[model samples]
Target: MERVEPMPLGGDVARRADAHAAAPLLNCLIREVAQRCPGQGGRRVYRLPGGGRLLRVREGRRPADPEVYTAGAWQRVGHTDLVKLVAEELRRHTGLSNDELPAEMIDSRDAVAALLAARDRVAPPADPYLRSEQSLVTGHPYHPAPKARGGGPVASWLAYAPEAHARFPLVLLAVREDALVEEGDTAALDALGQAPPGYRLLPAHPWQLDLVGGDLAGAFADGRLLRLGTTAFDVWPTAAVRTVHAPAADPAPGADLFLKFSLDVRITNDVRRLWRHDLLKLRRTDTAAAGAIEAQDGPAAWLSDRGYRTAAFAFEELAVLVRDGLGGHVLPGATPLLAAALAEGFDGNPLDGPADPAVWWEAYLRQVVPPVLNAFARHGVVLEAHLQNSLVAVDTGGIPVQALFRDAEGVKLLPDVTRAAGWERLVYCLVVNHLTEVAAALVERHPDHDPWPAARREFARHDVPEIPRLLTSPTLPGKTNLLLRWTGADGADARYLPLPNPLSGP
Candidate 1:
């Protein structure tokens, strides 16, 4: 396989890490910011509007062979060069300077190198669920630095990295009941382990503990918090990284439970903490989502965020969310897989099988489309139905039978956000981010196939007012992750650029 341009880095692993990290960052640069420059030789070249330097790459879905036109010849760019080049270009483009983004880019590349090396030593989990979780090496295809791990040390995050296929037990703690803060139903937690009198059991993500342990020294010293040891069973980290699957939750089958923790690390566009504001609204939002799903017809399910619990002193750092697991909701005999993993490809992805292309695409639409529309149009609930937040279940025949959506924190209540804002967010998540990736992957494996026509038909059936405009609009809102980071905007604040709508084009 093609790796990064020759570098004095470690080995195949480091070069591979460079290639993986650089591609997504370059994708954002080329698509959202860079303008097409007339070609030279046989290479595809683009002029960076900000830096005014010609950048060239082997053009495809994921661009490679990044070179900058300098002096006389094209200088092959390494990961560090690419980061500097991106930072310079963004500075000129935005007329702003960001000291943090460049470091994040370097940190992201370094994290990938670490993950690559760790995966080489760790065996991927045999379970399809865990395998799918661990398989996202490329990560967010559009984000400039999807794999960045808060710029922390490798040893600090490696043991909990889903990409490394590493699984470990939760570091159980006893928060003095007087110090315990909670919301919603956190009853399921009590079954996992026990706590001493006047102490409530609070399970902590091992990595999060390591990251913020020093920050909580006083609580431990005052006996407000006591380490109650670790869970006897290991909960495998999912693709989301912070959330984990305890396959054995005793009476509550593994499928019926998930524990999401706050990691003091910035993942994707945000510091992935179960923020206090979001946690406070979890019940209202999740209830809206669950009620919407229950009212609809089909196998679609909302993996409700049941509740959260944490110590008052370390609310954000120690908070853990209980999410409904995927077991009871899944159809009988159907196996569920991560939607992102399917698009990105995993060992046993049904999309990779010999299923009929047309039937497969149609089945996929039937399972994924209607519920999302129904939830939005009928109930005014906006779900972050992106690939990672969605799971598709397929039968023994490899045909999708149901769609399950999770991460209530990403959901927006109807009146909570203006209808316009919510619809735009829903459109960005469902169509641009979710469906587009899956459609492209399907077309990639079957070149003659066009997934958009079916997609167009499915979307058209929805009576939502935006459907007509969406069907004919030449451009869809594309999120600007690279620029957003360079400009140092809030991660929750989405800024969009116009992208050619595939449903409108051939």
Candidate 2:
């Protein structure tokens, strides 16, 4: 066996030593050992050519023996090569270098692959209740009935009872074969046995059906239509859908929970577009768009299933219709907290007293930034930490406590496939997209505060305590292009901030 010597752990030698420095050497050693051993799981301690030992750790959870080497045994190894090896693997996998990474981690190659695979295989959900032309004329017979008490008579002969309420204008019952009904319509009320005194029935318009698109199966599967009492509300339909009041008393205990869909598909579309763009930028062009979709959705669903504070909805497609309603009824004082901060605008200062730069900085560092950093460190995921994308939920006293991070479409695995692409994008989103925007807003609001310096100090103190390099980093102009555009600045005046490379331990 070729003997290897572990480096000494003091002075300049210790400073240069890292887990990764040992990876190439360990990898070579492991290959040699595997050739000799040919086993699924095993551990061996070998004395190196140097005065140290190599403790090989092999895990057999998978078909092949996954091996890692720690240079220790005789004396406690202060600078284990395993750290560098893992760090390198992390960089290869997520794009973040060791300095940009979190303090802890949950490593599972299969889990990571599964998540990546899931992003590519997302199919739009289905809605079983929708009416198709072929089904309307052929499978189910449609019987037209006289419009109810307050409503006009049905205009189409094909309108049926259970589905009759699918038409619009609940009060008039103006029958259009395809007109869609609101969740709180009288026809739905009648089905629920809670019809109001002046309830009316209506037929759906044909044009409305055309707007609903083809198969309802996908919509239903995707959670677009949910049952409320006896009526089904269009939860995530593509078009602009609205909710109206029904005269009946609340049916379910939690009936007060109003479910409104989103109007702009841009949020979801942006997520998909960004995800694909990032993947392509990282040179993972071989991975299909389906892969990206699956990767994004899998973690989203996982997080939702695990009960994180995500915007309460199912798919990105559903976000269009649901977000507005969710936004409307956000816990009463929550909007004001966010609005107060956003109203200040985005500039280059951070010390505006009216906005309490200290308070904002503290809250963000202690509460907001930690969770996000922790998530990345522990899970290899960088959440969408942008201002507009995040919701600041506060208590009745107006003190910000909990942060509601929405738009899962933006959450990505750090240390993405390639080194440069993943790291740059992660830095762009975290530092530029989220942090810089907020910093600019703070600075704009408080012109005298010198926002950049304060922000650097704050980030250094909390997010990357090990690396103080952020404090001395120069500004990047082109990088802050988004902020400049938002600030309505032209060319020369916009100040861009450049972040220091993390590894140097600034």
Provide the overall lDDT of each model, using Cα atoms, as 2-decimal numbers. Answer: 0.86, 0.30
Task: Write model 1 residue lDDT over 59-160, tens digit each, in one string.
Answer: 767788899889988899998989888888888887899998888888888888888777766677787866987799989989888999988777777778
Quality of model 1 by C-alpha lDDT:
0.86
| Decoy 2 TM-score against native | 0.35
Task: Write down the RMSD of all candidates, one decimal each.
Answer: 3.6, 25.5
The residue-by-residue lDDT of candidate 2 on 32-83, one tens digit each, is 2222333323544443322233344332111112233434322333223343
| Candidate 1 to truth, TM | 0.95
Model 2: CA > 4 A from native: 1-355, 395-399, 414-420, 462-472, 475-506
Model 2, total clashes: 65
Q: Which candidate ranks first by lDDT, i.e. highest?
A: 1
lDDT for model 2 comes to: 0.30
TM-score of each: 0.95, 0.35
